[model samples]
Target: MRRAPIIAVVLALAVPSLARADIQPHKAIYDLVDEDGAATGGRVEYEILGNACDGWAVLQKIDIPKAGARVVTTNASWEAADGSAMRFHETTERDGQTVSRFRGQAASGSNGFAVFTDGEGGESFGQLPQGTLLPTLQTKTLLTQAKRDRSVLSSNKVFLGTSSEGALPLEITSVLSPRASTPGDHPELDGQPSWNVTSSFYEAGGRPDTGPDYTVRSIQFGNGVVQSMEITREGATARARLRSLDLYEVVECNR
Candidate 1:
């Protein structure tokens, strides 16, 4: 799921070319595509923020080409991608009551995050973790403990560890280019503006031994709302795509 976070970043686009000031809150649905430019039956949801923080929901399905028989939140981020001060609190319920809570703050160049999870028995933050410092292009960090994969925070750089056990090197695949606006009465259904974006990821950064080039196609906003995205290897047998079907308002934690 290395493409997960990058999908969120796609939704957060403050087009440097646009003259608009205030960004509208919106929700968008994206159509995922493969390397061959075919639909992959995947989707994403982007919740544009009214404040400094934005929200994302990702779903990759199975069994059916367009739907998932097994689905878990692959990843979620409630941070403002524009590098502003922000805070977020998230709660989940299984049968009725709250089962988890996540709260954090991001101020200018620095940010903090924490998570509290509750099982079927009860809720607790006993093992919750915390971190300080907002993730950035300069703050390249390893997100997973696995030795076979590499994921980083920067946009233009790919840092594969010294010991990787893969046939191909996973280099920086895509760098987001300028956005093209959405036209007509559609208004992107997500309230926020829409755009067409592309990223070019390399095989040399992590898969130096592999042949061919791979890229990702995405639609997003500056506040971190990814409408849709897809990932495909140059010549892989299967590629995955994600799309979002609906969007609704959630509770605001600032109160």
Candidate 2:
């Protein structure tokens, strides 16, 4: 137990055209189960590399199986082009050694963003208030505020410098559902047009009866693929489907 910062829920992403729509780099694979479904042996792979005119890269990996044979890995990465400027790193290993590590950088400070950190708890500096949003620009500002306020959107205050024992403050809540179609074993997500999201991660000023510490229910699509997800904490729940997906080939920026 005790390892629940909710894993940052592994971030989210995609739409294109309009200059490749903020972001759309892909490579995903998920299959983890718990909450009675079993199979907690572990699995999660993530990738979102480059685009949005140049600047985006994220890699994630998590494997679990600890006890006899031992195997626990958790890796993370992020490199930003402009999402308010960012650079982060993370690590955790077990059978292969290396226990913990973290590195950080955040910019865009006129009065709102400026954070710098160094691993295993060493250096630190923080201050994020004005419009604070980092972590792939807060998932592209929660899919453009859940597509222009279709319903419930407008609650953000994020900054996860991948933990240097510092930069911690997450409070995001975006909900918008009622336009769906696409889930027939994927089939390249059929026609698109999806939304049945439900994100909730709190701790920044946490209230609302101290409920959310982690929550994510997904469907996303509409370009930013999410396919399916269900992550809860405390009550214990874990699910992530969308076995495989790949789409990354868009580089046309000459302006």
Candidate 3:
């Protein structure tokens, strides 16, 4: 079984709330750690912009400093407000040298169909399965289930281009429950209603009974902010702790 890097998990995680009410636009910073709970001398900077009218904009940066090398990935993405389309560009750098770059887009037809294509050849890479969703819609679906007191969160498929080899569809299942009280460096999130979300990922078309390729545990706030998260794959764990947060007020888009 193969899995994405720990930091890449943060890239695929979505933070924005639903439309109209409680739409959160914010910046979150986190400190990285390894399986033994030791600091990794790296950090993650995740930002969300745009609103329901213009869709969601995301920019994520991961920087990890090793003994003699460094790995960094900077990704920028946007999803349509109608949950019908998305576009993304990503770059990965190692030791101050860029090693990889790719850009792609996904769109649904008027008949409720979509495809995700990559590379500069302008060809259809693959036809995504029905009910596939990008970040904003993905979060909305989970939050909706959470509000309805559903513990077993389900998603048909998710396309995040999270794979190092290339973009791939992934099947996600999560359990949502009330979060226990936890302290954080940010006061605004203190005592806020939160949920303990644990998600498991399987290959898009694989049988879930065979077991998940990886798992992620996170504390998600009502305002669509994440307090902390851990990724465990094959017993190797990586964690991210909230270091700082800056929340932005949702604004109206005047036509």
Residue-level lDDT tens digits of model 3 in 1-255: 123355666446555547544657889888897766577788999888887788788888999876779988888888887667888777778998887666777765433333334334443366666667766677777776676674645655776655432345678777888766655436878755678888887765567888887888988876788877898787777798888889898877664
Instruction: Give each model's whole-structure lDDT.
Output: 0.34, 0.61, 0.71
Model 1 CA lDDT for position 254:
52
lDDT of 1: 0.34
| Alpha carbon deviation, residue 72, candidate 1 (Å) | 3.0
The list of candidate 3 runs beyond 4 A from truth reads: 1-4, 35-38, 109-124, 150-152, 164-167, 253-255
Residues 1-255, candidate 1, lDDT per residue (tens digit)? Answer: 113223333332211111122233445555445667576654444444334233222222122132333222222334343433333333333334443433333343222222223233332221111222232221112211111132223343322111110112134433333344545323334354344445554533355356425555655444334445554454443333334333344334352
The TM-scores of all predictions, comma-separated, are 0.39, 0.32, 0.86
Q: Which residue pairs come into collision in candidate 3?
A: none
Residue 90 in candidate 3 has what lDDT? 73
Clashes of each: 42, 2, 0
Query: What is the Cα-based TM-score of model 3?
Result: 0.86
**How many Å off is the CA of 105 in candidate 3?**
0.4
Error of 1 at 147 (Å): 39
Tens-digit per-residue lDDT, 1-255, candidate 2? 124224335443222222336345677776677655556666667777666656766767767666865445454545455566667666667788876665667664455554544344666666777777666666666556556665556577767665422555577776776565634647776765567778777765568576877777877775666766787777877776667888777565654
Worst 10 residues of 2 by lDDT: 11-20
